[model samples]
Target: MLFARRADWKATKPDNLHEPVTSTKGVKVHYTGTRFEPFLEVHALCAMRVKEIQREHMEGKGDSEIDYNLLVCRHGVVFEGRGWREQNAANGNRELNRAHHAVCAPTGSGGYTDVPEKMVRGIQDAIAYLRRHGAGWEIAGHRDGYATQCPGDLLYGHVLNGSLDPGVLWDGGNHIVRGGETLGRISVRYNVPSDYIILANPDDLDASGKVKDGMKLWIPARGVPLKGADPTPGDDATEFQPFPGAKWFHEEPSSPIITAMGERLVAEGCSEYAKGPGPQWSEADRASYAKWQRKLGYAGAKADGWPGETSWEQLRVPYVGQKPGDFEEFPGDAWFHDQPKSRIITAMGKRLVEEGCGHYSKGPGPQWTEADRHSYAVWQRKLGFNGSKADGWPGEYSWDRLQVPEDDD
Candidate 1:
């Protein structure tokens, strides 16, 4: 592999260097996030770019040195930055920097979607070198913990799919499952059969034939797709996933369901994820869910980030199961709180009155009123909801049950 020392690139010696990072969870893959020039393929230009990056990090970003431990060029040449000796600043914040070593590639968005094979090889080389030093086994993209799209989509996909891993050979070795992966998903990942994996590690799975995060399973060599057919995500990637039960959310380990939920939260403009809404549950998920709850008129402890049945139903994540019927999407609790004059509200009031839940003394006009809450509360009680769940707020489940006429308003 072609390699260059800092001296080779004439990089200015940085005045500040942090204590050496002797250990880390793994390496984070990054991209230049700038337009790439064809001329950069030349080693000299690559060197110049490396210098430019150092200058930018040191002068522009006020970093003590180049943020990456190493950088890979288009031609698969690895250039030393901090060179695995010092901590990197490119992983977003202090905690993230402490956890993962950073390696950047000279690639970016817009006309730079496809990554070169050689570039990938160089990144793998950097990762391998880091591992031999003190890095752990996980390989992740910068976006895994950071909010920005540094590595971009194509490369980030490679990181998640293990294309960036130095090893792809499945030798029936012991495999450790991480958050967001199951036996079925792992089997598809390694081209191994589900039954074969189950047969090999009989003690690792639970009664339901599922693997938990951090569980170790021995995978037999690649076998015919489960039952001599191709494998698909099945319910794993559905339009509307059934709530995996409250326990799954409250206590289950990292899961793709959580990731799906995070994505939904983001879609609903209620994201609080700083790093990832990845498969693992974190404060970000709770904070984001709290936003969703508050949007739905929940307050105080009611707006807590935990996913309740009503809130989860309202989020309507596209995961494993679908909600039946074509009721109008919940316009959000905030909308009703705004007391907007609209035909939608009028129609909803009519439905509440028809259901014998209306407490209105006057017309259930376009304008919202306290009577709407009283009526909705009655409906919620009729549905067996009490306490906070019975609050007059129009939850998605109750709203759907009411089947208020669809209105342009």
Candidate 2:
């Protein structure tokens, strides 16, 4: 999805502003943490909220724009907040403001909500854009750097688990085969199961497993590749490598190892072919790798599939730096609890109730009251469940029904 640039903000520039110090310390993620009523004008509401945050910051409370350097809406639209070179007051620490880049996900009082997949991809794209333009480091979510639940729970989990795999084709559609493509070749190229390719392209195959060239075939965007035995003699020997060093590519954040593998593959043929980060990998890189792999007689010459270790070793690729999944630090699981609760708790409670859980209650504190019971009932009903009258008693069926697994153990 393409993002429309914020021309209005681009037209205005601050005077004599000191550029922020760009360091690779960490990335910070945040939530707008404001209540957004449905059916209201979204853009206007967001603009108003941004203004309010600016007012609070300028009143000697923080640096002047909304606390984040960028804001992502539920609809997946990205808006500019603070300039990259300017300090932001959104995070509580001034020192962090100088070193960290901030990005905000739109959320209400709820800690975090469903972030549109497109928005997540857009965030990755923005980070890549920033890095290419010399923002000085890779991207990270707000929870990564500080103790807070800013980007929402689901998204935070995606980043933590390395599952989101930003920068790949995410439209989740089917691809049609062009001329000069073979099923076995295409299947290996995309890491898609051969059966999946066959099933998707039923019209092209005969009983003998023959597929004619130029036949239209349906290929699912996200599918697992078929694993094969090691390439035999005369098989292409080119391997997959990744970009060198800790440099971040805007696309494919999840599989850094593959990127490194691709880099090594190129280096094997021509040392000059392996260079440091210049821009996001282009079709040229894919074409070059394909040429090398084909010349080496490797079966996996196409650049459309996820890379595995076998692909790397067959092409004589070396693992570079830390393996893709390695990380030295991570914010503790209870990070979200530290964010000011003015909006998060209320929103999360309401969401829980809306999802068919009833009588939602906050933690293990002793402040239970009739008001809490009433709120719980309302939340339950909103979630489309039958809620009983307000009853402030622990172990009540409604209370039990409403409990969510706590992140803190």
Candidate 3:
């Protein structure tokens, strides 16, 4: 029988495809315990393996066709097997037969091994195809859904950690930046606060506060924080005290705002020469003025590792025109107080959507579009918010956004 080359394998459904199964719960990935003698011959071997599976199902096991829904070879070829609509008998458990689709990876050995780039891509494509077809599935290793270690340790590790899956692949996490990566773009891509990225790698600090490609700073695994420590000044205290000389912006004094604002100044191309109010400015009226200057991008604002006057002017206050409690109805003042939650801005609106802070409904009121969800998910992951099912919703994890420090440098 003629076998199709792995390279030519497309994700098309078979002409005799069955109706798609409904309510897919998860995916089961396997590793074929086979090795290719020569790397170049791997694709052919993979094609042959597909034929073997079909033969086994058709004759030996007395089944209709291949038991697996898809197969990926070391060469990165993807082959449609039983077809997702058809019930697969690959796993011994009957419950999984109705809710899971089986995908197999060609393992060089029975144990841990490096999956070829091609094969990894093929697996990602297969998963993407399945998800697009309304499969309510999360990628899983065979060990997750079955009583077997069929996909092996290496593959299993990626699945458990939520890495090397369709989401990361299709969403641009696969690309490696050499040096030209700007913190703004990276912040938008990963939905992380740009300031946090700079804080993580002060050495990457450019005069403009953005990281350039080939800068060699570590992109913390998505959802991992920079220092992996509290960004807030006083973790032990509930109420925040004003830094000496720094005027309190609010009567209660919000620590999160202080840290988030400081980080934002650093990201918006602030210079390091700027001076933070320090403990002195903590209670000074000029502190808010300093923050306003940093936000406005005043000249000389450098993330140069120092908060100075140039940074202060950039964040210069936007002319509130009225005192805090004046009943004259200052729209600007209200806008300032109701600035859509500073945490929301720092975290990015999209990130808020991912955290499920707002509903993803068809209309508005905190609902997000597909692009919004996708972008925010990426950003949330970059900020080390990994494993947070909330994605961008304001929850306990998002509270961490408030904990960022003001003067860590």
Highest TM-score: give the candidate number: 1
**Overall lDDT per candidate, in order of appearance:** 0.72, 0.45, 0.47
Q: TM-score of model 2 relative to the true fold? A: 0.37
User: Per-residue lDDT for 191-253 in model 1, tens only?
Assistant: 554655664665676436687788878776431112221111111121244555566667745
Each candidate: RMSD? 21.7, 27.9, 26.0
Clash tally for model 1: 7
Task: Give a tens-digit lDDT track for model 3, residues 1-409.
Answer: 0113223332223334444575586677787654423321323234434554565456557665667877776654456676556666676666776677777776746323677655665676566655655455577777764677667787777677765465541222223455576667776675443444555555656436754455554444322223442222121111211122223343434343343334333333332324431212143323344444545554343322233434433442111111222112212223323334333233344334454543344322223245444444454454445543325333222233323222222
lDDT agreement of model 2 with the native:
0.45
Q: What is candidate 2's lDDT per residue for 1-409, written digit by digit as tens? A: 2232334223223323545655434456676555533311223233333444444454426443445666655544456666455576666677766666766666656423466665565565445434433455444556666787666666677667654333343223455566766677776665443554554555676434566655666654431111221111110111122322333432545443444434444434422234431223555445555555555555643543323334434654322222332322222224332433333334334544456534534432224334444555564454334422222222222332343333312
Worst 10 residues of 1 by lDDT: 229-238
State the displacement of the C-alpha of residue 123, model 1, in Å, after optimal TM-score superposition. Answer: 0.7
Worst 10 residues of 2 by lDDT: 229-238
Runs of candidate 2 exceeding 4 Å displacement? 1-16, 22-26, 40-52, 59-62, 135-139, 163-409
lDDT at residue 295 of model 1 (Cα atoms): 96
